[model samples]
Target chain A: MLSPGATIGVLGAGQLARMLALAAARLGFKTHVFAPSADEPAFDVCAARTIAAYDDPDALDAFARAVDVVTYEFENVPAATAEFLDARRPVRPNPRALALTQDRLVEKEFVQGLGVETAPFADVPDAGALARAVAKLGRPSILKTRRLGYDGKGQVAIRGGGDLGALFRALGGAPCILEGFIDFVKEVSVVAARGVDGEFHAYDISENQHENHILAETRAPAAILPETAVRAKEIARRIAEAEDYVGVLAVELFLVKSGRSERLIVNEIAPRVHNSGHWTLDGALTSQFEQHVRAIAGWPLGSTARLGRVTMRNLIGDDAERWPEIAAEDGACLHLYGKREIRAGRKMGHVTRIELE
Target chain B: MLSPGATIGVLGAGQLARMLALAAARLGFKTHVFAPSADEPAFDVCAARTIAAYDDPDALDAFARAVDVVTYEFENVPAATAEFLDARRPVRPNPRALALTQDRLVEKEFVQGLGVETAPFADVPDAGALARAVAKLGRPSILKTRRLGYDGKGQVAIRGGGDLGALFRALGGAPCILEGFIDFVKEVSVVAARGVDGEFHAYDISENQHENHILAETRAPAAILPETAVRAKEIARRIAEAEDYVGVLAVELFLVKSGRSERLIVNEIAPRVHNSGHWTLDGALTSQFEQHVRAIAGWPLGSTARLGRVTMRNLIGDDAERWPEIAAEDGACLHLYGKREIRAGRKMGHVTRIELE
Candidate 1:
């Protein structure tokens, strides 16, 4: 088990890594962020940082030797990088969890194989396979790259009269998955954690809203049927147990309402802290970031009780310009990622509010 | 007004500066700590730090030129240091406030001059004056050095048959104040802030318990009479206005319960964040550290609403060894100063817990 003064090596240096570093610091652990960018947001607050590329062997070796454990901020860490670090130090949510979530087909298959419901999906390798998959999944499906897709990127929506051959060629004939669209009443997720002792704790379900395919808001204690929420928690538990997950995991679900009945379909599993869990910063007994640190350190799981009715909103782009106003407001907790520039569609910060009823 | 990208120069490099830097970073501001200690705790988290004595003019000039404003973690900043920086950048809480609080006699005089009640005090310069003052004030008076005293140091209790000359000689024979003891019920403090725009916000009073003259625990929404708490707030407001203070200030009070009626006597003012206000980190809508940063930056004061019944306990020396257990607790928020060693009576970290009713 990693102790309080141990070092944590983070693979990426984005906002997630920054928040994780801050959380780790609060737990008496130091963070060493290794990223190619010179001024990644995470570097600003970390105890140590190496401005080196992921493939830089010397930097990776030094980082691994310095830290007691390794973790990645995002799922796109190269397989070779993970293997290299795993040889030197413990890397978790483990390389297997990363490998499973890095690809679309593998993730869906793994979830479904665990007796969990997922959206119907078919692999399309070429034009002929695309046509076959189109016929099998119907025209109103999304053709997403089997790898490297995030925030609605690297995916194209197919409707009636959309050319299958042209669409396949447009995506450069990369291996892809065709997912049949589900009429989701609401998008919800369970941000849960598995401790080193295999104890699982899940926060209240969070309902998410996406604007321009980017998360806009997340509300905890999601206004979903009680049974559906329970089922969502169970799905997360089974997935964590099946994977032997040792850190925070987020399972996104599509809630379908039918005649006063609710059904949940597994959308995806994120093997790291989820944006929807941001509300935990102020609205829950323990934040998801802190939970992730504890789980990775082989510590006991903290309480998952929601403190009050909580709402979290992403401050995308210029929305962060209202920080002065937000900071002045009562009960508004504003967190700004120290990003130099605020580009369009970039998440600059977030605000969390807890309302006591 | 300093903007987000501006720099803040801090005088002290202790845990308070470490916390202030962290708070400033959250608002996208960089911090530059000027301290003589090479192993200053704040150096690990700040963007820049200068290692030189406060009297080093060259280092002070460079530090003052590097930041947009100046603030200190403690009130003992040499008057020359404050003046040197004040000529270059704005200094919040102003140097006069520091001068007033740095000496026990000056602080007592200032409070009484404002028509605020304080423990009856008399200037004691030598053995003769000490005897005379004790005779006038009666037994059980506190003889404290006028300057450079903290955490039970530089003070001696005078009871019947005590060695007055030896006690006076032991205290370095510096200027001192002899304060008559108050038969009080509790020690509480009001932490409040005044923004540049003249807006004032105060967190609820916190009941403080001291061990060896160092703060041990603080409970927010102090168990005191409602009118007495209001009077404490009013006294703080009056002091802030009198000083034209533009940042957080803490006023310690002695609550004397005589019959069903309760009255308050001013103890001393901390021209910066007080240890008693540490509970605000997790117990209030806005933490005292963040509020200080905001007030110093000429921004809006955040809400001081209490989140719940909250308690903060300082972890001194070996107490920090319990960090692992504290981290595992459900709602406990533990914060450790990145100090290297845990010397006896040294404050290494603190933990804040908010209890929901």
Candidate 2:
């Protein structure tokens, strides 16, 4: 196991990486963040940092030599980058897990192969294929690029009387998947971790809300049946075991009401700590970031007991300007990512408010 | 008021400074640490650092230029260094507070002037003064150097008989304060913060236990009468107001049982975060580190609500070697200071265990 004082190399320099670096520091580990950005939020807290492209082998070599283990905040990290680091130092969650989750089509098939339910989907390689898939899946289906999609990007909806050629052109004619939409009553996610010893622990489920296709709010101990919550966590555990994952992974699911019974459909899989689990930072005995660090370091998993009923709100765009107000609010825990520029729809920070049980 | 993106200048690069830097980053503030040590714990998480002795004017000038406000983790910051920085930028908790607390005799006088009770103390500038003070205060007294003493250093306990001249010589002939033993039943401390607007907030009192004159353990909601606790907070507020404090300060008190009534005698004041308040990191809504940052930045103080019953244990020397076991303990929060060498009597890390109420 990597001991305290060991340097951890994180691949991204976004807020997720920032929080991970802080959590690692709490455990006495120094983090070295590697990203191309000259000054990202994560750089402020890390012990060392490298401003270099992911494909630069020389930079990767230096980073590998400096850190005891390598991990990433985002799953879209290049496969070649992970492979190069793995050759010298251990890359946590492994390259195989990254490959499986980076592409939407592969992730869905992997979940289905494990006997988990998913929406009806078809591959659309070109305009002609899109036409056929649309015919099969019916109108009002979402056509999303199989790779490099996040925050409702690289996607378009095929609604009544839309030209297949234009629709395919809108997505740049990239390889894609067309899936029928489910009228889900609620969207929930299970954030879980797996250790090197194969022990698994999962935080309570978080029911999520999206605004402009970006995560806006999350409430833990989601208002769902206990059995449904159990099933959600079980699906996350099965996926982690199948991937042989050794870090925190989040599985987002759509819960639909069917004939007075509840059904959960696996929507997507995130190979890193997801935003839905941010509430765990304040409301759980162990935060998801710390759990990820422990799992990657080959340590035992910590308790996942809930500390309170939690509500987390993301401060997108100008929302973070209210930091003063939020800071004054009684019992409010405000976390602001050090992003100077205020762009529209950008996630600048978040606040977690908890009601003790 | 310092904006979220402003840089905070922290003096002394120890674990207390390390924690303050982390908390500042959470609020989107960058920290520039100034210290003589090259690899102190605070350097691991700060945006920039200066490694120069406190007496170096050039280093102080650069640090002042880089940060919006200046603060220190320890009260021993030299007078000239603080004045140098205060000329260029604001020095928080003010230099007067540091100067007062640095000298035990001066701090006791200040506390007593506010109608707060303190143990009888006499200044000893020479061997002759020591004899007179001993005769008045009686036996079993503590003779501590007036300045630059910590963790039992620079102090000697006097018994029934001893050579007065030898005792003064043993202390290097430095000015001293001889305090009469009060026979305190318990040691409790109040860690609180005051804002620029004269607003004050205090955490629940913590009962402290010391080993070899170093803080070893702390229990929050210290087993004291409710009225005594309220009175303790009142005494702390009076002290902070009298000092015009603008940051976190810890007031150490001696709880002496006075025949069915408990009386608190102000023992000392630390003009920075204290070890006894470390439990707030995991057991309270606002940690002392975070509270200090807010007060120094001119931001509103956060809620001081306690999460549960908390017990904090300091990991001195080899105590940190049990990190693996503590990390695996259910609901235990372990924090290591990342000190490379585990020398005896050195503070290595700490752990907080909470029983939720």
Best TM-score goes to which candidate?
Answer: 2
TM-score (0 to 1) for chain A, all models? Answer: 0.98, 0.99
What value does the TM-score of chain B take for model 1? 0.98
Query: TM-score, each model?
Result: 0.97, 0.99
Candidate 1: where are CA atoms >4 Å away? none
On a 0 to 1 TM-score scale, where does candidate 1 land against the true structure? 0.97
The DockQ scores of all candidates, in the order shown, are 0.57, 0.84
Cα lDDT tens digits, model 2, B128-192, are 99999999999999999999999999999999888988999999999999999999999999999
List where candidate 2 sits over 4 angstroms from the true fold: none
Best by DockQ: 2
Residue B32 local lDDT, model 2: 95
True contacts kept of 2: 0.75
